[model samples]
Target: MSKTIRMLNKDDYPQYEAMETGIEFDYIAHIFDRLATGDNHLYGLFLDGRLVSVGGYSIYAGSYAMLGRLRSDLRFKGNGFSTEVVSYILNEVFKLNGIRWVGANTQEHNTSAQRVLEKVGLNPYITLHGALTKDTAALESGAEPWQPVTSLQRKKDWLNQAYIRTGDIFPYECYYPFPASAELFQDEAIKQWSFYENDDKTRFVITKYDQKKYHYLHAVYPWHDLTSQPGLWETIASDYRKLLQQTDDETYIWMDLTKEEAQTLPASHQFELPSPWILYGKEN
Candidate 1:
């Protein structure tokens, strides 16, 4: 029998939840929550009257829509189900609303998902890197303590530099959007740090001290030469260690790096994990 695609309903959540996507545990609730709010549209592909694949798109400002929680049953793999479902979702997104572009992302190493995205016409564009450090022993071994940026002027200066750096590296329109201003950085929960080289501002990192689980070093933006700067990673690790100490409740610090920037770091800092992720997009 041929497969049929249709809008998903609340009753369909249980079956959708049961689908065995390895990352489902992290996203199932998020998908349903968005569905409940009626801000997004979810659809399912039915085979033999049973839901085998599910996907959705969320509308964003600027006529942009993002594909979310695309998954199909493992038993139904290799049947082109994922590609079909994504095509259906993108078609619906363009027809039902005024969406000008649709975007999605998958782990760089997940070739199966990438192929499905490509089949649906969303091209790959950018790469992002992320890592986490627990116990801070590596950072503290041989690095300088990071300096706190208490001055509002310095914070503004760093934000400006970061904006320029972002524009310089990613001139393309579809790169991940960044917060527009320094005021956005004034999150009461996060502490910011700056590492200077020879009295000139060189690099900066932001950390949020979570009371329950771990500290998060959300970003590390460097301005000067990263490769020439010996022990830069160690300095960052050491700084993260100090941030981790501020909260007895947390033991880990997470870091987000760009692929371009990560390549400039020394091998000791380059923990070549999976290639960040590829952002895919298509115009309606």
Candidate 2:
């Protein structure tokens, strides 16, 4: 038996696309595009020159790295191939300069992947409830409209409060937790974080639109005081209603919260709550 792990290039896409990994990778073209632009690094592990496991990581904000797009051939399950590939990718990520933290997100129900992540020295950091809705009319309206926030200091302050509320990790995007720091706000090239706040300045959400990759409205909450704050859900719903009025795309919302906090969502709204996701990570 022989094993090899190395970087995968565009030429390897055919072999990657041919793998029967039992997973639907809709972002194959997106990942390859990023690889071409130097924003992504994909790696594959081979057994006797046969591709068995593959994974990739993306660096951002000049200080954070996110691991994702991991898939192993169904035939190679229970052989520790995922662990091998992940371990190798983790090593490769730290070899690059200026990476302070590395992390990955997985559904809470995926215990096997969790085990592999833990074996590679990553631990569960935070959990987020993924909720989505397409029925814009069901959401509440008439609340104060959301206004774009222009002050970087204000955005940083909001994230700081959320960081303290959620133990230190800031759930900044769909499945990525960033370390609480001021530097993350300084880099707009990695990600252009658009900040918004309600009329009274109590409710805040950070959003970005990527029609090709992320959903039309990708929202991350800055605070989790949902249940305690009156009219919180209504305000958020109003924000969604306003955004949906501009486009017909389905809206997706991610919030770092406990199961109890998630119940604060308005019962009338059409958001479907899926199995919560857990983010696993360790410092580089």
Candidate 3:
């Protein structure tokens, strides 16, 4: 028996597509195309010339990368092939220069994959519930105006509040939790940060266009303790509804909130809260 692992090229797509990932998400299904386009770094592990396991990573914000799309041939399960592929990919990635952080996301139910991720030093750092909404009718009547936030250097107090609310983790994208810091807020790629505030200007909402789906709106807001700020939900709902009107009917807004906040969402709102997803990461 012999095994070999190496970076995969576009020609490996057929074998990659043949593997049983058992994941139905559009992003998971289309990974090979992204890899072919140089958007991702993909690697494969072959046993005796047969492709058996695969894993990949994508760089974000020029300072960090995320591992994803790992899968194995269904027939080759139970032999720790997934672990081997992930560890091999991590070793190869770190050998390159200037990657400050690495992260990965997984569903809560994927215990096996979580074990593999942990074994490779990507420990669980944050978890969030995904809430998606498309109903315009649920729009609340009124709320405070959202002032565009171009920077956070002057808002030291607000940044502290955000850290307390989210444990120093900012839900930068739909499911990606990035370190909450003023330096990160300075990145040019994430200029869509905004805030809805009363006199104090403590509340914030950061919105970004989903890279994979043109019609999707990814928004994250760190409101400390929904119990004390029940009225904020109206602002959130109205914000989504107004944005929905500006886009095609198929467009939907996505928010990553705590499980408690998701469960407490007003029934009048049209958001669908799915199971919480876990984010794992390692800083180098």
Question: Highest lDDT among the candidates is held by which one?
Answer: 2
Candidate 1 C-alpha error for residue 87, in Å: 2.5
Model 1, C-alpha of 22: deviation from truth (Å): 7.2
RMSD of each: 5.9, 3.4, 3.3
Model 1, position 35, has a per-residue lDDT of: 73
- Rank by lDDT (best first): 2, 3, 1
Residue-pair clash count for candidate 2 = 0
- Between 1 and 3, whose TM-score is larger? 3
**Which ten residues in a row are the worst by lDDT in model 1?**
170-179
lDDT of 3 at 208: 58
In order of listing, the candidates' clash counts read 0, 0, 0
- The whole-model C-alpha lDDT of candidate 2 against the native structure comes to 0.71
> Which lDDT tens digits does candidate 1 get at residues 184-284?
34433223334333224566644433321344543354444544444555565665667666755645444545677666655555243455766787767
Please list all clashing residue pairs in model 3, or write none if there are none.
none
Residue 230 of candidate 1: its Cα lDDT?
A: 42
TM-score versus the correct structure, for each prediction: 0.63, 0.82, 0.83
* Model 1 alpha-carbon miss at residue 14, Å: 2.5
Off by over 4 Å in 2: 24-26, 29-37, 135-143, 146-148, 164-167, 187-203, 210-214, 227-242, 245-248, 251-257
| Regions of candidate 1 where Cα sits further than 4 Å from its true position | 1-4, 7-9, 17-41, 58-65, 91-101, 135-161, 164-198, 208-215, 222-251, 258-275, 282-284
lDDT (tens digit, per residue) of candidate 3 on 168-224: 777666667776544455435444554455445656655556644545666666664
Per-residue lDDT of model 2, residues 118-153, tens digit only: 999998877777665555344444354477778777
